[model samples]
Target: HLERLRALAREVGLEAPLYTCTAWGGAAVPAEGFLPMHAAYPFTPWEPDPSFEPVPSREFLFRSPQQPAADWWQAGAFRYPIERYPYAYCELGAGIQMTYLHRPLVPPECTQALAVVALGSGCNWLGYYMYHGGSNPPGRRGFLNEFTVPRLSYDFQAPLGEYGQLHASYHRLRLIHLFLAEFGDRLAPLPVVLPPGASTLKPQVTNVLRYAARAHQDQGFLFLSVYQDHAETADLEGIALEVLLPQERLRLPHEGSLRLLRGMSAILPVGLELGDGLRLRYATAQPLTVLHARERRCVVFFAPDGLQPEFALARQGCRALTVQGGSSAEEGETLYAWPLPGLGTRLEATGLSGRGVELLVLSQEQALRCWKVRLAGTEYLLLTESEGAAWVDAGEERLTVCWQGEAQLDLLSYPRLPSSLPATGLLEDRGTAGVFWRYRLQCPPWKARWSLEQPEPQVVRLRLAAEALEGVRDLFLRVDCVADVGQAFLDGHLVADYFGSDLPWIIGLKRFAQPGRELELILRFTPLQANAPVLRYFTRERLPLPASDGTLPVTVRAVQLVPEYGIELPWQE
Candidate 1:
C-alpha cells in the first residue's frame, strides 16, 4: 500500500517528505518500513496544583518540549531520526475539546502564551489537533463520539466553534501565526537557549520572571510571558532580569528595569538583520507582522501597555539616521523609544546605505486584532478590533464574520483602503492614522423572526417562516438557556449536541435550512446533575433521561436568531 501511494505521488510530481503520526502505546503502527519522520501528538490536560504556585507551573509547561528530551522508547520502539527532523509537534494544542467528566475551560491568554512558549522551546512546526471543529458523524449503532464525550458536539471547546464561529483563543493563536508567517524564515534555525535555573526551577517560584531566548549568529528573539490560567497571579513591579545567551549575557532594557504585568507576553528581537546595513539590537515589544509597500517593508511591533517600547539599532556604514513619530537617544547603540498607546506610529531610518526597513507600532489592544489578509491583489495587516473574522476566502471573494450577541464590525487596514472596495456591507470611513485607513463594517439587518414551542416536557421547538429568510445570507441561532445537556435536531435528525459547560449554544441554522421550506428545529435540554459518579454511568445510561430533580433546575431563558454578514475583497479587481 505504501509503495503504491509513493508511486502515485511521484507520478503526480509531488516531492514532499512522507511521514506518519502514531501513538506510543500502539504496536507495528509506527511502521518500521516507513520513513523516520514519525511523531506523536502531545496533550497536557492542565490542572490546578494544590501545592505550588500557578504561575511557575504554567511557565514550566510552556518551556518544556512536547517530546521527551532523551527517550529510551525511541531506541526500542522505533528507529526515530531525531537529527533529520526538527523539534516539532503533530498537535501542540491551541485549545482542547472538552469532555463531560473533565471540562477545562481554556482562555485566550493560555493559548497565546502557549504559542510563544512553544516556538521558543524549539518547536519549528506547530500543528493543532482540531483547528476547526465540527459535528461527529453518526456511527452504525450511535453517534461517533466516545462514551465520555457528547454525541454531536465535537467542537466542545475548540478554537473555532462547530459552526465556524471564531472564539477568543482563535484570535490569540492567530497573533502567533501572523508572527510566525513573518519571522519564521529567520527563526527556524535558532536553537532555544534557557537560563541557568530554568531546568531546576519549580512551580512555587513566582519571584522570578519566566523567559527564554533563541539565538543564531547572535541574532534571534527573546520570548517573555507572564500569563497563566490555572492560578491567580499578581503583577511583578520593577523586575530586574538578565538574558543569559550561550555567547554573551546582557541586562534587559539597557536602561531601567521593567514591570511584568499580569497577562503580559512579548517576543523581543536581538541583533536581527533587517536589510544590508540595519541590525536590530533588541526591542521590549512583540513582533507582529510585516507589510510590504512598493519599495520598503513596514516591520510591525506590538507594545503592551504599562511599559515604554524601545528599539536599539546597529549602524553599518551610516552617516545619519532619523526617526518619525518617536524619539532617539544617542548611546553605545542608538536607541529609539516610543511612548504608550503607540497605535499606527511609523518610524523611518534613512541611514545605512538607504536600505532601512520601516517600523509600524501597535498597542497591545490593537495587536490582538492584527491579522493578515489578502485584499485586492495585495496582503495587508487588518486590525479587526474586538470584532473578529471567522474565515477569509480570497478565491470566493468572501469574508465571514461571526458574532454572538450584538455584532460590531470594526476593521483597520494599512496602506489606506478605499471605500468602494468591499463587495458587500457598508465600510464607514472612520479616518486614518499614518498610512492606515480605519473603517467600520456595517451589514444588513436580520429578516427572519422565530417562535418558540414546548412540544414535550424537556423538549422545545423553533419555527422560522421560509418567506422571511428567503434572501438571508446566514442565520446564527443563539440559545441562551439554563439547561445542562442540550441537543438540536433538524427534521428529527440530530445535528448538534452540548453539555452543561456550553453556557449558551451558538448553532448555525443556515446549513440545515431547506430551500423554500420553513425552518423547524427540535431541541432537548436536561437538568445538570450535581454529582454524577462515573462508576455508575453505564447503569444510568440505560435509564430514561431525567427532566429535572426539583432540587436542580432547567429553563430555556431566551432564543435569538441573528443574520450574519459577509463582505468580499476582490483578488483581481
Candidate 2:
C-alpha cells in the first residue's frame, strides 16, 4: 500500500513519508496496533475495534483506580533499534471517543497528564489521535466506519469537535505544545533517564512520586504526571521531587517542597540557558514560550497550579540584575531566588556577557489564552479570553478570526507592532493589558436555535431560523436524544445514522446543503434491543441505560444550531 502511495506521491507533486501502521495489540485487531512513531519509524498504529478505554493504546501509563492493572504490559514503546528509530510517539491518546460498551468522558486533565507521562517515558515527538473529530463520510453502501464506531458521527471527544469547535482539551494540551515548539529541538537528542523508583512507579501507587528526566550530562527537563485515567489517587502533598540526571541527582525548588494536585503535569527546566549568558539552575514553573521583540526577547512561563512560581538563577554566570513587577532575593550567596507572581512579573537581567535577558510570567489561565501568530514580519501572541481560532492571510490582505463560543481578543506583538490595527465590528481598543491590546467582541451565546417537530410517531423533523445560515461558513447541528439508534434521511435516502448513547451528537449540515434547494433532515428512530446483552455490558462499564418498558425512548430532548463565522478584517501591517 505504501509503495503505491509513494508512486502516487511521485506522480503528483505531493511530499509525504509513507509507512505501514501496526499495533502491538488492541481492541480494533488489525486496525488497532502501535501507530508507528512517525512515517520514518517502522511502527504504525494498530487500533482495535471498540476500544473505549481512555488511555487504551498505552495501557502501562495508567491503572484504573477501581481496578489497578498490576500486570498490564508496557510494550507500547516496542523494543526496536534506539539509535536508528528514536523512542517517540506521534499518536498518543490525548483523547479517545467513548465506545458503545464504554461511555467514559475523558477529563481534559488526564489527556494533559498522558502527554507528560509519554514524555517522561522517553517519547521525544508527541502527537495525538483525533485531536480533531469528524463524521465518517458515507460510503457507496452507507457511512464509512468500523462495526464498533458510530455510523456517521466520529466525535472522538477530541480537542477540536466535529464542526471545528474548540474543546477544553484544546487549551489544556497547547500548554505542552507551546513548550515543545520552543524547547523540543533541544530536548529531542537528550537521552531519557528514569530514576529507580520513578521508573517502576505503577499507576495505582499514589504515595510514590512518578518522574523522569531527558538530559544529556546535566541540562534536562524534569517531567512528571500526577493524573491517571479511570483511577482515583491521593494528592501528592509537600513532596520535593528528585530529578535524576546522568551526572548526579538534584532536588527541585531550591527552597521548599511543592505539592502535586491530582490531574496536573509539568516539565521543569534544569541547567538551561535562558539567553546567551544567564544559566537557570532550576524552576518550579513550566516554560510556556519565548516572545521576541526586535529590541528584546521575553521568555514567558506559566505557574503550575498549587505551586509557587520560583526560579533559581546560577550566580556564576549572572553579572547584573533588574527586576520588574516582582522581587528577587539572594538564596544564600550562590544563586538568586526569584519568587514570582503569576502575571505582570518580569525579570530583566544583564548576564555575564552584559546582554539583556528578559523573563515574563503569566498566570496559567493567561498562558492558555495565548496563541502565537505571525502577522506581517513580527511574531505576536494573540491572547484570547476564550478559544478563538485565527487565520492570517497577508497576501489577501485579510485577517479572519473565528469563534464558536465566547470570545475576547487581545493583541500583543514583539519586536514590531503592526503599522495599524483598526478595531472594527465588535473589536475596539479597550486599552493595553501590559503588552496586550485588549478587545471585547459582542457576540451572543447562540446564533440560532433549532426548533424540534415530530410530524409523525417515531419520527423527528427539525427547522432552523434562516439567520443560522446567513453568514455562517458552516453550520452544525447539536442533537440530544433518548433512544438506542436513529437513522437520518434526506429526501428518502439514508444519509446518516446515530447510536443514542452519546448525547449532543454534532452533525455537519453544510454537506447536505444544496443551493436553491430546500434541505429537509428527517430522522427515523430504530433503537436497539432494550435488553440487549451489549447494553448490559455498557451498564457494567458504569454508563447505565435507564431502560423504560423494554423499549428505548426515541425522544429528542434538545436541538441546537450553531453557526461558525470567520470575522474578516483588513490584514494588519
Candidate 3:
C-alpha cells in the first residue's frame, strides 16, 4: 500500500521534497528515504481521583520490541531503533476535545508549558493538531465525527475560537512563536541537556524543579517548566540555577535567589548575542521578539506576573551606554538591575560596530497587545488594546484596520507619518498615560433578528428571520447563555454544538441559511450538576439554578451579518 501511494504520486506531477509516514499508533518501520513522525499528547482522560497524574504516554517517547504491533503493519517490521531518524513531533495535541465519557478542561497556561517542554526535550520540529477550533460538517452516511465525539461542534477550545475570536492563549503563544521566528534557525541544531534531577522526577513530584537547556556554539537557552499536569504545585522560593555555557558557567540572578510561581514557564538566555557590541550575561526575563526601527533595534522581553525583572549585561568594546527608567548598578565588568518596573524600562547602549540596541522590558499584559503586521512590503509593530478599527501609516499612505466591532483608532505607531491627519492631533510625549491617536468611524449594522422560545422542558427553539442579506457575506448566530452543554440544529439537521463556559457561543449560519428562507434553529441544553466535585474544584462558586424545573435558559444575543470592506490605497509607482 505504501509503495502504491508513492507510485501514484509519481504518476501524477506531485514531487515533494520530504516524505513522511505516521509512526504514532505503534512502532512501525519507516518508508525508505522518508521521515518518520510521531504524535504526542500531554494529557489523557480525566480521572475523578485527585491523585491522577497527567503525562505523555510511553509510546510517544520510546520504541520497544516487546510491544504489540498495530493491525495495519506486519509484525516483524514493527519495532526499530528510534535514533536513526531525526526526532520530530508533528501532531502535538495543543488542546483536547471533550468526548461523551470524558470532558477535561485544559487551562491556557498548561498548553504553553507543554510547548516549552517539547522544544526543550530536543524536538526538531513542533506542530499542533488543531490550532483553531472548527465545526464538523454533515456526512452522507451519518455525522462526520466518531460516535463518542460531539455531534455538531468540533471546537477543541483552541487558541482561536470557532468564530475567529481570539483567546488569551493566542497572545501567549504568539510570544513563543515570535521568538522562534527570530532565533529558531540558530537553535535547530543544538543538543538538549537535561538538569541533574530532571530524569528522575515523576509527574506527581511538585517540589523538584524541572529544567532543560540547549547548548551550541557558546550560547544556550535555559528552559524552565514550573507546571505539572493535573496537579497543584506550590511556589518555589529562593531558587538559584546554574547554567553551563560554552565559555563560562553562569549563575542566574547574579545577586540573590529568585522565585518560581506555579503554572509559569520561561526560557532564559545564556550568553546571547545582541548584535555586535552587547552580550547578555544572564536574565530571568523571557525574550519575546526583536523590532527593527529606523535608527535602533529594540529587543522586547516580558517579566512574569509576580517576578521581578532582574538581568545582567556585559559590554565588549561599546563606547557609551545608559540605563533609563529602571534601577541599575555596575560591578566591575557586569551591569545589573534589582527590580525593573513594569513599564518604560529601556537600555540604550551606543557606539560599537553597528546600530544601537534598546532593551524594552514590559509586563505580560502590555505585551499582549503588540502585533506585528506587514503592509505595503513594510513591517509595523502596533501596541493597542482596542477592539476597533484604526488608521496606521503604510509607507507614504495610510491603511485602516478593522475587526468585528465599531471602527476606532486607539493608538498608532510607525517610523514615518502621513501627509494628512484626522482633526484630532497626534499626541506625543504624554509619558505612557495618553499617547494614542483616537478616531471614530462608522460600520454596517446587524441585519438579522432572532428570538428563542422554550417549547419543551429541555428544548429551545430559535427562529431567525432576516432581510436584505444579499450584500452580507458572513452571517453568524451568536448565543450568550449560561448552560452546561448545548446542541444546535438547523432545519431539523444537527449543525453545531457548544460547551458553555466563560467564552461566548457562536455558530456560522451562512451554510445553513438562504436569502429568503426562514431559519429554524433548535438548541438542547444540559444543566450542571450541583454536587459535582470537579466543578467546585475549578470554579470555586456553587452552581445556581435558573429555575426550579431543571431546565437551562438559552438566550440569542445577536445575529450579525458582516459585510466585506476594502481599503483603497493611493497608488505610487
Candidate 4:
C-alpha cells in the first residue's frame, strides 16, 4: 500500500521532501527513509493503560532498537531503527471531546503543562489534534459520528470553540507557541538530558520532582512538570535544581528554596542570552516570550500562582536601574527583581554598553487578555477584556474597540500612540436584566407566560410580539439544559443543534426568526442514560445530570439580544 501511494503520487506529478507513517495502532513496517510518527495524549482520561515508560516511541525520547519485533519496547515491535529517522510527534491531543461513555474536561492549566512535558521528553515536532472544534454534517447512513459521539455538535472544548470563541486555553497555549516561535531554532538539535530516577518515578510519588533539559553547548532550558496524569498531586516544597553551565554549575533561586504548585509546569532559562552585552544567570519564573523593538529587546516572564518572581543577572559592568513599577535589590554582582502583585509591571536596566534590557512581569490573569496583532505592517500587543465584538483593520489604520459590561482596554505595549480617538458617546450598561428576555411555558398549547418551569424534550411554541424585539438586531435563544443532545427548530425546519457540556447552548435566531411576526419554535432534547456503568465509574461523586422523570430537565434560560457598539481609534505608522 505504501509503494502504491508513492507511485500514485509520482504519477500525479507530486513530490514530497519527507515521507512519514503513523507508527502506532499495531505498528506496521514502513518503507525506508520514511519517518515513523506517534501521538502523545498524556491527559486522556479514558486510556486503557496509564503507566509511564522511557522509550522514545512509547515514552518520550528516541532510542535505537536492537532487533525487529522486540517485545522489550513498544516501538521496537515495528522493526524500525530509531537512528535511521528523526523522531517526531504529529498529533498531540490538546483536549478531549464529549462521548457517550466518558465526558472529560481538560483544564486550561493542564493543557499548558502537558505541552511543556512533551518538549522536555525530547519531542522534536509539536503538533496538536483538533486545536479548533467544528460541527458534524448530517450523514446518509446515520449521524456520521461514532456511536458514542455526540449527534451534531463537535465542540471539543479545545482552545478555539466551534463558533470561533476563544477559551482560556487559547491564551495559555499562545504563550508556549510564542516562546517556541522565538527560540525553537536554537533548541531544535539539542539532546534531552533527564535527571536520574525520572524514568522510574511512579505516579503516586509526589516528593520526587520531574526535571529534564535539552542542552547544546551548556546552555539550555530547564523543563519542570509538577503535574501528573489522572492522579492527585501534592505541592512540591523547598525545590532547588542544579544546572550545569559552560562556565560554572549554578543553583537556581540563588537564595531560598522555591515551591512547585501541584498540577503546574514551567520551563526556566539556564545561561540564556539576553543580548550581546548581557546574559541571564538563572531565573525561577518561566520565560513567556520576547518582544523586539527598534532600540531594545524586552524579555517577558511570569511567575506561577504560589512562587515568587526572583531571577539573577550576570553581566560585566551592568548596574541596576530604578524601575517605576517593580522593586529591585542588588547583591554583589547579581541583581534581583520582583514585580508588584496583581498589576502587570515592567522592570528596566542598562548594561555597560548602554544597551537596554526590559522585563515585563505580569500576573496570570492579566496575561490572558494580551493579544499580538499586526496592523499596517507593524506588530502590536493589545490588552483588552471586552465581551463585546472587536476588530482591527490594518489597511484603514483603525481599531474598533468594544464597550460592554465594564469592558476596558489598557495599552500595555504598542509601537506608537494613536493619532485620534473616537468621538462616539459611551454606551450605557443596562446589565443582565435589561438584555435578557425571560419567558415560561403554560399548559396545553404551550403559551408563553411570565412564570413556572417547563419540562424537557417537549416542543414549546413561542410567539414574539414586535414590541418584545423592538430594538434587537441579533437575537439568540439560550437553553440551559442537562441533556445528552439538543436540537432547535423554527417553523418545522431544524435550525441549530447542540451537544451537552458545561457551556450553555445558544441558538442564533437573527437570520431565521422574523421579529414583527409570530414564529413557531421547537426544542428537542435527548436524555442521557441514568444507569450507565461508565458514568458511575468515571464520575462517582458528581454525575452532572439533573433529576428527572424519564425526560430531560431543560429550560429556556433567556432570549438575549447582544447590542453592538464600536469606537474607532485613528492610527499612524
Candidate 5:
C-alpha cells in the first residue's frame, strides 16, 4: 500500500513521507505473532508509596539498534533513558494528564499550575491527551464496577483547569496557533534544532510532523473546552479579515445552545453580538459543509478560496435561484446573484402563517412554488422539474396524504380455556408452501391472546388413573387459536371464524365447540394464511382455569421440533 501510494504520489507530483512506528503496551499483541518478555508497570501489581516518587516496576522497554538509557522518556518519542532495557519508550501505561484551552473551566483554580511539560519539551505540536476532559460516551448503566470508566468531568490538572468558563490555556494555545499558522510550512520541513539556554525544555531534532489537516499544509489549530457552548468567532486583529483563514471563530448567538459536528470541516461559528451584523465564510467543498444556527441575524459565507462574493443567508419570502448562465442569485429587493453552473440554490424561511404563501419565479411566465406552513409556522420548499408547485392550507390540523394504499388487516381471537397447539405437517416434497401446523389462539374471557405457528402434531396428555383425580376445579380442554384465512376448530368444533382473509389468532373457544370433557382439535386452514405454525401444548391440570375468579396460573411446557434435511448427491459411501 505504501509503495503504491508513493508511486501514485510521484506520478502526481506529490510529497510522501512515512511516519514512525510506536509500541502499544501489551504482553501479547493480538493480531501479530509475537511473545511477551514481561508485563507493563502500574498494572503489574506494584504498590504505590506515600512519597509519590518514581519506583521501578515491570514495564516493557524498547529493543533498539543503539545503547540503552536510565528512566522513561516522557517528552520525545525516542532518546529517552531506559531503566531496564536498551531502547527509548514512547507511550506510558495510561496515566492521567490534562490541558485546558479554548474555553476554561467553570472554576479555573483546580487546574491552574501544571502545564504539559512533557509534549511541550520536545514535540512541535502538543495536545493534552485530554485538556478540557469530559465523559466517555454512555455505555451500559447500573453494572458492577460501572465507575471503572472515568467520571463525566475529564478535567485533568493542567494550566487551565476544566471548570472555568474561559481557561488561561485558551489564550496560550490560540497565540501558539496564530504563531504556528504564520510559520507552519517552515516548521514542518525544518528539523527541530534546539538552541541552548533551555535545559528544562529538552529539544531533540526529528522529522516528526505531529498534527495534520488535509491541505498541503494546515495552518490553524482547534481547541475544545469542557463547556457545551456554540461556536464563537472573535475579531482576530492585525490580520485581514478576508485573508486570515476563511474559517474562524464562532459563538452561540442564542443562549444555551451549541452546534453538533457531523464530521471534520472548516466551518466555525461567527459569534453574533447583539445589534451587530455577523458575517462568516466557509470554502465550499465536496460533502458540503452545513452550518446549523438558530438566530436569523447570523449569516453564513460560502467563500471558496480564490473565489469571489461567497456569502448566503436564509431569508423570508426570498428564493435562491440558479439561472441557465451558471449564476446563482437570492431573490430580494435587487435580486443579488452569483454565477453557478451545477449548484442549485435553496431558500429557507421560518415563522410563517398557516394559510401559506406563494413565491413566484417569473421567467417568461409565472413559475411559482407554493409552500404550506408547518406545525411550527415554518415553510419548506423543494425545487422540482415543474416550474410551479401549489400549496393548499392544511387547516388547523396538519393534513398529510400518507401513501399507505391498502389497510393490512388481521383478525385475532380471544379464548376462555388456554391450551398449547403444535405447528408443522408432512408434505410431498421438502419445499416451502406445504402445510405446516401452527396454533392461533385467543382468550376473550381472560382478555389474553396467543398463538403457535408451524407446530408439530403432539399432545400433552394428562391421564387421571381414577386415583390421581385430585383438585379438579373444572375438567375442560381448551385450544387457543387464530383464524388467518379459515375457521379454526377445537375438538372438531369451530373456535375461530374467518372468511377470505389472512391473519394470526388466539382463539380457544369457537362458536361450533367449547372445551368440555374431551380435548381434540381439527384446524381448517386456507391458502391465504401463513403455513401451519409451530405448536406449544400443555394440559390445563387445575381446570376451570382460575376456577371462578378467572385468574389462575396456567402452566405450559415447550416442545421444539426442526426438520431434518435429505442427503446430498454424488456421495462415495
Candidate 6:
C-alpha cells in the first residue's frame, strides 16, 4: 500500500517526491515492448522450457473470457482490463490511449478537448507514440515477426506519420503545446470537483480497501477502470472528466441512482478512441499531461493527483521559451544572461539528446553556430554566464540564445551518447602454426574496413614462410576482403575492387569473394569521422599469391547480431 511506501520512505530519512509518475500504456496489453502488438499474429518466441513444450508465460497467445473457466486456467491465462470487474461498463474494456502528441489527420478539436480535461484533472508530463518514425534496425535473432511489426516508418497515424510527413494530429498537439506555453499554471493545481452520488465510476471496492488508505501523495492517485465503452457526457455531479467527447453522448444508466461518495482518490480510467466512430479501448490512468488550446494558446490538462509542475506559466501574451543556463535548472525558474564576445555574437543551445547540454551562436535570426558537449562525469560547468532563451514552439526542445537576457536552466532527459567501442585487437584463431597467424579483426562503428599494412614485403613473406608447421595452409595463400572495401594485389594475377557501395540488409551476408591458392591477404580500411580526427597509416611493396580453385567459402557465424563478427562461409540460401 502507499502507506507502507510512505512509512518506508520516512524510516530511511528519504525526502518526499522520491519518484516521478509515469504511464505504462504501450501498444500491447502486458505493457512490455517486446510483446507482440497483434495477438492474432504473435511471434512464436523461443521459450527456455526444457521439456520441448511451449511455455505460455514466455510465448505469446490469445485467450478470451467467453471460453470455459477450465480453459481459462489452461496453459496461457486470459487477461481482461481491471475495469470489467464490479461494473459491466464497456468504456473500461482494455487498452486505452491518451494523446499528448499525435500525428496529423487526427482531429485538432478532439486533441484540444482531451488536453483541457487532462489539465483540469491533474495529469502533467506527456509523451506520444511514433514521435519520429524510422526503419527498424537490422533484424536480430529473427525473433521479430515481420507481419506484426509496423514498417520502419512507424506511421501508426501519429503526429509524425510514417513518411516523415506532418499530419493534422502533429499540428493539433503542437498547438496544444503552444497553448500550454501560455496558461499551463492555471491548470496545474486545478482540482476535479465531482458532484453528488457518482458511484458507478468510483474506485472498485478492492482498490479502495486495499490501496487507498496507504497511498503516498508523492506517488499521486490511482486510475480506476469502469466497464464502460466511451465516457459519454454525464451531467451527474460526481464525474470529473479530463476530456469531453461532445460529438457523441451516452446518457447515464437510468437504472440506478448515481453513487455520490469521495469513492477514493485512487485509480482513474482512460479510454482510447481508435479508428472511426471513436470506438474506445479501456486503459488505466497513468500520470501524463494532455495539452489543449482555446485561442491558439496551449493549456496542459492534469489528472487529479497527477503531475504537478514546479512553476506554472502565468503570463498571457509572450510565448514560453526554454532557458538553458549553460547548465541545469528546475522547472519554472527564472534565467539570466551575460555577454560572450569570443564565442560569436550570441550563444545558443541545441541538440539536447547528446550531452543533454550544448552551446550555440545566433546570427540575426538564424542559428549560426552550435557545439555538441558531453559531460565527462556527473556534472559539467559553463564558465560563461549569459541570458538563456529558447524558441519554445511546439516541438523545439533546444534552447535559443537571446540577444540579451539572464536565466537558469536545467537539463531533462539528456540522452547519453552510445558508448565507444574498444580498440580493434587482431588475434589469431586457426591456421598453419608458425607459418600463418589466423588473425581476427574487430571493427568499430567508425571503422568501415579492416586493413593490414605490410612494411617489409618480407614480414608477411617471412610470416607466411614459417608455415611449415602442420595444419598450416600454404604461405602464399590467396587474400580476400569480405564486405564493403575493395581488394587489390601486387602480383597482377588477381584484382578486385568495389568502392562506393552500401551493404543492403535485403541480401543478408556476402561470403568469401576472392579465389586464389597462394596469395598475400592485405586489407584496406576507410574511416568515417564526424568532425573528428582520423588516424592513418601507409606501407609499400604488396605481394601477390598464386590462383587456386574457386571452392573456398566465407562463413558468417555471428549473423546479424551486434558485433557481427564471424566467418562468412559461402551461403547459397
Indicate which candidate wins on lDDT.
1
- List the candidate 3 regions with Cα displacement exceeding 4 Å: 1-4, 12-14, 46-84, 338-343, 375-378, 387-409, 412-452, 455-457, 461-485, 499-504, 509-520, 526-573
TM-score of each: 0.82, 0.80, 0.80, 0.78, 0.21, 0.23
Return the TM-score for candidate 3, rounded to 2 decimals: 0.80
**Model 6: how far residue 569 lies from native, Å:** 56
TM-score of 6: 0.23
Please, what is the whole-model Cα lDDT of each candidate in the order they appear?
Answer: 0.64, 0.63, 0.62, 0.60, 0.24, 0.24
lDDT of 3 by residue, 1-573 (tens): 665777799789777887777766555655476677766666664354534545533221112222222431234443446556666777777777765435567677777776777777766677776689887777788777866667667777777766555556666677788789878876777777765544445666777677877877668787887777666688888888877666776777776787888888878887777875787777888888887754577777888765677777775655556777777777777777654644456776663765667777777776666666555444445565455322233444545443444322344343232223332233222223222222333345545466667787457777767553443434555665555677887767677886655445677666677768878888887765544333423233323444565443444333343332223334231
lDDT tens digits, residues 1-573, model 5?
Answer: 434545686788886452222333322222222111221222211222212223322121111212212323332323222232222223322223211101111222112111112112222333333344332232356222122222233333223333221233443333234324433443333221122222222112111111112111222221111111112222221211221234433222211222222111122222111112211122121111122222332111222222222222223333322333234454333233333312122222222322221111111011111111223232222111221111123334432211011111111111110111111111112121111112221111221122334342222322222321122111222333222133334545333332221111222122122233333444443331122221111122322233243322222223121111111111111
12-62: candidate 6 lDDT, tens digit per residue: 998664322211222213322111111110112122321232221210111
Consecutive 10-residue window with the lowest summed lDDT within model 4: 434-443
- Judged by whole-model lDDT over C-alpha atoms, candidate 6 comes out at 0.24
Q: Once model 4 is optimally superposed onto the true structure by TM-score, how far is the C-alpha of residue 535 displaced, in angstroms?
A: 4.4
How good is model 4 by TM-score? 0.78
TM-score: which is higher, 1 or 6?
1
Model 2 lDDT per residue over 492-530, tens place: 877766665644566778777776555678887765566
Error of 2 at 525 (Å): 4.5
Candidate order (TM-score): 1, 2, 3, 4, 6, 5
